[model samples]
Target chain A: MDKRREVAVLSELDKKLINLLQHGLPVCERPFAQVAEQVDSTEDEVIAHLVDLKERKVLSRFGPMFDAVYLGGAFTLAALAVPEEDFAKVTEQVNSFEQIAHNYRRTHYYNMWFVIGTESVEEIEQVVQGIEEKTGLEVLNVPKLKEFFVGLYLPV
Target chain B: MSENNNIALTSLEREYIIATQKGLPLVAKPYHAVAEQLNISVEQVLSMTKDLQERGIIRRVAAVPNHYKLGYQYNGMTVWDISDEHAEKFGQMVGNLPFVSHCYLRPRFLPKWNYNLFAMVHGKTPEEMHQLRSQIKELLKDVLVERNDDSSQNIPTQSNDMLTSTEILKKTGLRLKDKTA
Candidate 1:
């Protein structure tokens, strides 16, 4: 938690506004105006607050969240257990792929977990195999068989 | 919803997705600005967005807060080894929890891995996350016990491991229909 990067304080209105925006923004011509009415602020004020929130790093991003699967793309959660000495080299090799959307170092034997997204299932396999060839570590490719839910609701 | 519609996006829809994948304009009239950029009507932009949402191609147009920046520093990828028969019911129950962000039933590779259900949890601190983990453990205790009795293998009946992220190696939004193959 870097104090300099985080927002020092959130006004009551900002809190309420964040809570409202999480559900979603209206899809219309005057969308901000609609949000303004609900949050009891002017349209301009709502837009300004959104900009300020993003700049302060409170909001990582604000936009349409597209589903890659629906768009005919494929993705998988894969991991590798890199030896302590080769961690840096392995990380560099794994992240070199543009298709590797996200990679995280977790505290476990299979320490390096990452997501691979590509145009199709074939591409996903190629990337996974390529990773194994590059890192000399077996890749644990776990594709989601079923999504119970993706409701990422964190109460502000 | 049928995830694989196999219906191709119209040229207009393709343009819309490519334009907004970077994110909608953070202005009062975001859609209008988008329409202006694409030389399309504002109504067409609104209608297409609605259609995409209905089709599940677009999950939502909303504010994605930085959980770490918002005081949620403790996040864990909690993995559980639920029996195949009871996974669906249990996974749904875990997904419904307010603290669980994303829950999924993924394939488990034998010997090295046995966990099938993955749930992501975030909290203000490790202590807070521990409390949430306890709640999850309590919820799954009964099923795990039942599973233990049915199994004849020498494997211990222990369940669940929380993999806390030590570092974020790389992160970037997936581009729409990226042709990097």
Candidate 2:
């Protein structure tokens, strides 16, 4: 909701650049250099524009998304409903834990949602328990009963 | 896809990403803004991100979880118990449904925990959600599931307690970090 932000107008040139980048930067030491040649921008300009778009929050992260299962661990998507008065304190505490990923304040009975990424199912279970003793409120551990393949992609 | 498929990355690159995940910056040249912070060439930042996408490392750059504005204020989890053999197929079919937001297959303890196929349905009202789930249930041809007759369907109970109080606290179990006001 920042007014200083710019709108994403996909020019043909910009679209082509994004299309090539979307396919992925090749696996190499100098990926931007390659993309630059393809996008008709110098490597410096390509990186500069990317940084700009990222600063504007157009891109989520410019890094690999992990496969938790392959990393010898699993996670559960969970939430809770903290009282309004205690929300800020809980947010600070919730945000402190690296394993919790990030917590968001949503509009619902179960609103204070956070993700748990931990080693082993046992660890995952333990993390959930630890969250309970720390906070008096009950936590709704909504573990996925099944898996669905989803990627964060938007056709700009 | 696999851990072995992973390529190494630098710390600065990781920092650049974490700062911008929530939203993009505003400027005629936002890339320059980000580059200035990192003290790197603007082109490097763009290509680093572009490369990450190509390598399948970064998924995409976009805003997320704006569900509130989307009018899906009502959302609930729906779990199922399809036979193991049919679970995978059922998940694919269930995920394809427009009403189904998420679907997953998890290990069950059998007899009691037969509902392995899970999907989430969001609607304006509880009844609307039920209707959508009911429709998806019909698509599970060979899949047998224990659905609620008296109440809404509960996830196959390996644990009868749906609100997992014990496990939830563990993540925040550590000492609270100091906050600078």
Candidate 3:
């Protein structure tokens, strides 16, 4: 946390770039230039700021956000309650599977939660079953029945 | 259109998605770079991307900030056990909240799990999140109270729990099949 406080402060230009980019980058040949025009910066400067931001670890990713479901794949949020002593062991076993996309240890009974992404809908179960067999823990598979909102944009 | 619609994607669109999934190059002409890779014109790449956005295949082409680094360290996965009859409408209302990044109605595993409505809230601290949670509780109070009054069998009308992430055990980007053969 202390390290984050000292990395770099966002300048007005950086702030404008983040604010504009969060909404989206134009889908054109010179998208950065388009963005620069909107942000009062040159194409070269916008690209430089973005590169600097990425290098500083401010932006995790910069690109088109693809819908996994639309790409003919299946995804789900699953959880497992692992014992304190076996947490490390369980993590190793669970992460061994490539299908596990994002795993988080939360403060709850069902502590170990992860998003599983598979090539097809049927494979979702197969991957969950494999994890159970390997980890010896019951997986509480909770797929989203309905999604109300998803996009997140924080102004800088 | 619904996200689950059976919209057939052309091969070119598939190629574009696979190529740009990792991201576009941070250059003066990012789409031009993508076009060169796919052996297509820059205009074609741009139009295809626009088409994908219109079709809801691509949510947006944007910069995803590292929330933790951006001072939004406290994130709670708030789950609620709202009645099935009103979950849809209630979920929509909850989703419209500014702090709620993701709102969903998911299946509940009985006996162990009873939560169906999940809304993920992002904040700088637990106190900030507590404030947001109270807002949600306030919004759902009337509905819950009405549910309890309506039926004696379904005693606990609505209940919620917040799960804060302690550690990121594993994280990987969703990868697509390579079709540049």
RMSD of 1: 3.3
Per-residue lDDT over B121-165 for candidate 2, one digit per residue giving the tens place of the 0 to 100 score: 666555776777678767874566444543343323321111111
**TM-score, cand. 2 vs. native:** 0.52
Lowest-sum lDDT 10-residue window in model 1 chain B: B145-154
The lDDT of each candidate is 0.82, 0.55, 0.82
Q: Write the per-residue lDDT of candidate 3 for residues A1-156, one digit (tens) a residue.
A: 445433347889988988788888877777887888888889899899999998887887899998777776778999998999999999999999998999999988888999998877678889999999999999999888788988787665
Model 2's alpha-carbon lDDT is 0.55
**Which residue ranges in model 2 land beyond 4 Å of their true spot?**
A1-74, A77-115, A118-125, A129-146, A151-156, B1-8, B109-113, B146-181
**Cα-based lDDT at residue B32, candidate 2:** 67
Clashing pairs in 3: none
Q: What is the DockQ of candidate 2?
A: 0.12
Give the docking tier of candidate 2. incorrect
TM-score of chain B of 3: 0.86
Can you list each candidate's DockQ? 0.62, 0.12, 0.58
Candidate 3: stretches off by over 4 Å = A1-8, B1-7, B145-158, B179-181
Tens-digit lDDT track of model 3 for B63-177:
9887766777777899887778888899999999977888888997765677888999988878988888889988886555222333534323347878898777887898877
Evaluate model 1: give its lDDT.
0.82
Return the interface RMSD of the candidates, in order shown, one decimal each: 2.6, 9.3, 2.8
Clashes of each: 0, 51, 0
